[model samples]
Target: MTSAYAAVYKEWRDDPELFWRKAAKAIDWIKAPQKIFDAGAGVYGLWFPDAVCNACANAVDRHVEAGRGDQAAIIYDSPVTGTKRTLTYAQLQEEVGTLAAVLRKHGVEKGDRVIIYMAMIPEAVIGMLACARIGAIHSVVFGGFAAQELAKRIDDCAPKLVLAASCGVEPNRVVHYKPLLDEAIELAARKPAAVLMLRRPQEPATPTQGRDFDWTAEVEAARAQGLFADCVPVAATDPLYILYTSGTTGAPKGVVRDTGGYLVALEWTMSNVYDVKPGEVFWAASDVGWVVGHSYIVYGPLIHGATTIIYEGKPVGTPDPGAFWRVIEEHGVASLFTAPTALRAIKKEDPAGTWLQRYDVSRLRALFLAGERADPDTIQWAEKILNVPVVDHWWQTETGWAIAANPLGLGMAPVKYGSPTFPMPGYDLSVVDDLGHDAGRNEMGTILLRLPLPPGNLVALWNQEARMRAGYLDDFPGFYKTGDGGYVDDDGYVFVMGRIDDVINVAGHRLSTGGMEEVIASHPDVAECAVIGMNDAIKGEQPCGFIVLKAGTSGTHERIEKELVQLVRDKVGPVAAFKTAIVVDRLPKTRSGKILRGAMKKIADHDPWTTPATIDDPAVLDDIADALKAKGI
Candidate 1:
């Protein structure tokens, strides 16, 4: 089949303004934009600078007005709590309006900031929409985040109010969120005016006198009085939300997304990238705190009038490895978007996909992997078992959407093992060497996006415009440095090897640890793996492989380690100098499933390091340390 990708890309490249202007027609605008783009506006430029719109109205009110009120808007499936609930558009509209009214009653106005620190529940989504409905900026901190980190965000945004839940239910324990929230408030320099607490039956919170408000009581009162906050018109360049990047150590950079361009871009991607029609079930198994949840889980699907799922459970442990399969079967999910780490976890627990066979996943047409590099081994495994196209796309927290993707909705290109095929419509991707010149075909270098980043991408850092320019623009003149090291192959496929820091110098040769990891993961006995460069006295740096064996693998650790060393030498060549390989039970990762390679590298080098705020489990780091010590490194 001939893919329309080439012609469509050309259409965008030839006249970018016209393309985006056409896309903007799908959204309902309070004041239509006459100026498509204003290069003199922002840190870079601005899109739809003269337009006025409301995100909540486009996502909720308009859908209801269009007579799709009976369609499912959000499907909340929490296996941890044995709960299943679905809210239709009309129902969601009512709840969102009530919450908006509550915010208005508390005096939150346009551009005021509100912080949402709740778990993966329906209210969390409601809080975000409520903020948008009244033109208030919402910043969602990851649930159960460290108090110090939360305090830092609190100080940065200086929110007028905070919305939180009492507790977060995990498979084994109920995490008390109230205490954490209180502690953070105590630590913060800037205090919120009020706190709205949602009391869960598992763990109810004590209200602070004259400060805390009950969520149920507030909403009920608002409904009884017929008080609902209507959508407020915001400038096209107005801030919608502030999301702190998870990987930061000190003060986190709050990525700010604008209203007009974000809606247009997300609406375009719904049919052009995800290929799901209105009312179709789309599930992104991610927490609302992360970029995936912000884009795919909340705004993207609803703005496109599709049913989105809020899954609160592990990929493997909610019941078994078949948990995701059951959700797919039950919800009739057309597309599943998640990190590759989730798939690796399921594959490690059930290598043969025995549990998957028990459920009918025939309704799932495509599986989209992002947030982490989708290794070929995991992708091939998912394709073999699910019998669907496993598309690996690439983007970042700053971009808010895919920079390079296969464009599944445009047409499926021939699958390449390691590349995220072709840059998306807005990104003009190029690979440059140390001196900022173009790199040779398939040669490793810093990947960059040409100037004037596409719509839906970050407009600026919250209260830090100078920092934004220094971090993204100053490094490369006229190009946005992606901070990722990769290459563009002769076929125009973009291969993101890993972060720029992941490239290590072996004597004089620069090697990509991601490439070595890809080779290590190809072993039949290997379920998951991470390759980090360890400092070496003679070679300057040497590659060390830490691997987790597949479930029920018959090979002994010693034999498999030897085989892995040989495999890297054979595939990546001896120039890799890949001699050490350790077999561990698991790897350290963040809650969002990104492998904590930097933290692992810090531990491996015996450098002073603190536990990452985003780590999934701190105990895993100790295990990694023990494994490294036993190897006599």
Candidate 2:
């Protein structure tokens, strides 16, 4: 018997237009799409071409009108600042309306750009919804981003207004946002006309005399005057937002999401992929800056009438490893979505699930992992502890939702150790060789999606059509190159090994660094590991494993290293050329919990490298350099 997931996928594959047309009915469209797709319209055609809709109305106003006014729309939990707050649908509608009025007062009109630079705060969500309400395109840059990086985004999007907070709270210190914003404005050629700064008690900022306005003052004045902005309908093909993802050329690639397509896609995922229902709490432990946060934390849950969570804390810090559990228990979170890096950090600190036992997370139905490859070791550990379906999905910032995921609402699929299940509806996944031909089963190659990418995927790069084509489409003509290297198994399970560049050539023999890391991470003493190809004059590049041991692990580092080397040799065979293994206290990661493998490789190769602006801690890079030096690499 075919699984429900497989049957639904076939239904979609049969007629994508009919499938998307059915999905579009879920949204409250001002003008429903008559044409599902227009092949000649955009970079890869367009979805819902004749539709007109307001994202904010569907997300906030409709819920209140549907008698869900008292339902909690958002739960703000900030352990770092000792703050917890909740907003009902009615309350959120009022807040978003007032903010939209304030934006209108400042001459921000439909199609005008607004940049939101805020910490994990309720107001950040309000800012985004406010922009959507007024048909203004909002671009969110991560708070505390370097002035230069922030300036690059400002120039790229050329926003008319900026929304920001006073400061961001970390476990140890406060990162002031005003200074960075000020410096960024000074650096940008195209400056925003105005800035609205939210004053936080932690570190209030002195605004620039001419350009800055107090967020509370503006919103309160608008509210007192009974000014509430109404939703403005925009064409479905209009750009909703521009989210910047890092590009190889050191320039930010702004990914544009269409209004109607985004609303439809996210709404479907909330029900099908995550199996979340309205009124139940769903938590995506990520910052508003990242794509996951944009899709799940802010847009998806709200549109679906589910109570979303904005958690401002780390997996291990800001109290302890039990922070996630506390939120789940307190909020009755039905599902949790986060990066695999977070679970590994928690496992490193509390390998025995000691912290987890303190809280009752019986309400959690499933745990969704993304952002990075979810190794088998980490998934198994989470499954053994949570006693819930730990689903590993694959997606990118370019694709707003999951590319490959096991549809929980349809029915559960059998768990595959390393695969991220099958491709979700609308994504026609193909594993192709370097020359664009289909690779055989289980053969490592580049992954591509067939032409005319589904709704919710990026419409185009902001003002850089040539770059988008050259970077993604040109490489594999007729397909959208995923840039990832992986293969489909006999059962049609897509296994994303790593980036195509991650496949290193050793003595003219290709080796997957992800394959080697899997073996090393399976060690009993290891909590997490990263394998990078080190420059070797003899073999061109040799695999070097860096392992982080679990808390209270016994035995010497040298002994563990020897065992890891032997483990990889046994699993990946002698052809892997994996001789070196180094045990480290911790691996360097970005603020979003992605291991900085590229930076690590550059360091190991003794090449010129600079600290990544997104790094969680600069000191961690120094530790890695010291470790490499100690090993005489």
Candidate 3:
């Protein structure tokens, strides 16, 4: 009954029903629902039964009415184009209303789906909030996702309308995404009616016949028609949005999140975890397509009425590494949230910079990193270089908002550098073994959330992929299995070790190795291939492919290798492609022809688990080892 770990969520664990309802008081709800629970004893959440509320209205409307109208909601920048803009609470309300009116003209009704294909521009947030305001679910595909990846999502959702930009700005030159967007539209069977374009980069884009029209013009037309109506009232459990997780499975699983329960959790997270000040400027360096952006960038900041910075360009592009610091100084940014992978990239590009010295980031008091655990070196680098404590928060797409956070300003939990600290106000977190028994101090096992799913947790899966309930929901009965292998130390700090299933994390991106292997093995010359993660100086782990060609494979080493790599690149985009590929005469295998990928990694990292189970062809394993040893990688 006495859990030292869950000092916060202990109230909820004792009487979960009461805790969830009590947590609801944290937010300014439109119509507080009649009941938190619909069914009986063992059954859990149906948060606000038939309650009518809007996510953006919660974010924009309520905060302004609370007399925070002049507070900046988002500080936006397009560094590549040398543009800067800021939206206050009042400004954001107008933008959302205009865009919501635009969607209404395009027939985006309450249950309609709108796919937003834009970079990390403020308009992306504008578009998303617009959809939320009108009760239409918006799915934003990450801009970097290849045409094929985009196409698959488009086909899956079959969204009513699409909101995209004419071009995108990265760190370097302008990336003309129109070509790829056009190509993807060509591929989709039931294509979107029209492509609304936000034309600013001016790249001489000839519209694609009747299917294409200007984005700004359409919104202007909508403004002429009438502003968006008051938020579409719905039950708290009504699906607000559906975000697809990056490829951890063959098919992307759509995580449907509702309005009320989600906002309750996010509002609590912004207040308790970050201890956000109303006027403080907050920047989360993530594209809206990812989960981090969804929570922190859009919902969390607005919930707290903080100035959320949305940078359209990559950090490096804005005059090298000085860009982030400049924004902090310019916008008077109080807090910044980002991933370690991004920090590593910036550090690699600008180690000892004139930028750091020239820029004033005194306004930046705290830093936060999520998506993956922060590397100790990066944490120290942030503290030493920026002279601010880097607060690390850990949670998954399923758990929604900050599950375990090192709340520096709020709770004064001492820093563990790379560790994910204590659970939030309403999460019953436990580390358990295979048999469902709890793990003791410092014992590593699966992280389980004994459920009545947490407030921010995924409610249900989308149509066909609803079977994921078996992969997730039914596993531990009431408890939602996190499926990650992690451990809780004596200090109550959490360190995630990787996924139980062959899900690999390459530079903080979660994906399936078997998913890639399956695509690679389908190639004609490739009889079989096993992908293994090799520790890289830059990326946390670089995936490498070891292959044994089929019979009568005769192409030269250089030629065949290039083709194989291309095959994978085409199959699953550059992200899933192997960093290195080794062609061996025969792969190390058991008598049953199982490739020993673990042994392959043992060449780079001499760990015991990296050792293969048992090899029938041990000599073949030696041959592959000799090849990698020669390369010294």
- The C-alpha local distance difference test score for the whole of candidate 1 amounts to 0.94
- Candidate 1: list runs displaced more than 4 Å: none
After aligning candidate 1 to the native by TM-score, how far in Å is the CA of 578 from where it should be?
0.8
User: What's model 2's overall lDDT?
Assistant: 0.92
Give TM-scores for every candidate, taking all chains together and pairing residue i with residue i: 0.99, 0.99, 0.78
Query: Highest lDDT, which number?
Result: 1
The TM-score that candidate 3 achieves is 0.78
Q: Candidate 3: which stretches are off by over 4 Å?
A: 1-7, 39-44, 225-227, 350-354, 464-466, 501-633
What does candidate 3's lDDT look like per residue over 1-633, in tens digits?
223334555676688668778778867767886677664422355666656678888889988888888878888887777888888898888888888887787778898888888877888999999888888899887664567667777887888888888777655556676787888888877698877777756464678888777888877877776665567775677777888776433456777888888888887777667767877888887778778889989998888777798887655656676778787788888888887656644664565445788878888878888775455655666687888778877888766787777765355567775567777666667888668788887776778776666677787767744465587767777777777767788877776644664456677765556555655555556545667777766667777777656545668766777776787788777886365777776666532123455566777565553323234345776687777775576
| lDDT tens digits by residue: candidate 1, 1-633 | 567999999999999999999999999999999999999989889999999999999989999999999999999999999998999999999999999999999989999999999999999999999999999999999989988999999999999999999889999999898988999999999999999999988888899888899999999999999998889999989999999999797887999999999999999999988898998999999999999999999999999999999999999989899999999999999999999999999999999999988999898999999987889999999999999999999999999999999888898899998788989999999999999999989899999999899999999999999999999999898999999999988899999999999999998999999999999999999999999998899999999999998889996899999999999999999999999999999999999999999999998999999999999889999999999989986
Model 3 lowest lDDT segment of ten = 608-617
- lDDT score for residue 233 of model 2: 93
Better of 1 and 2 by lDDT: 1
Residue 15's lDDT in candidate 2: 94
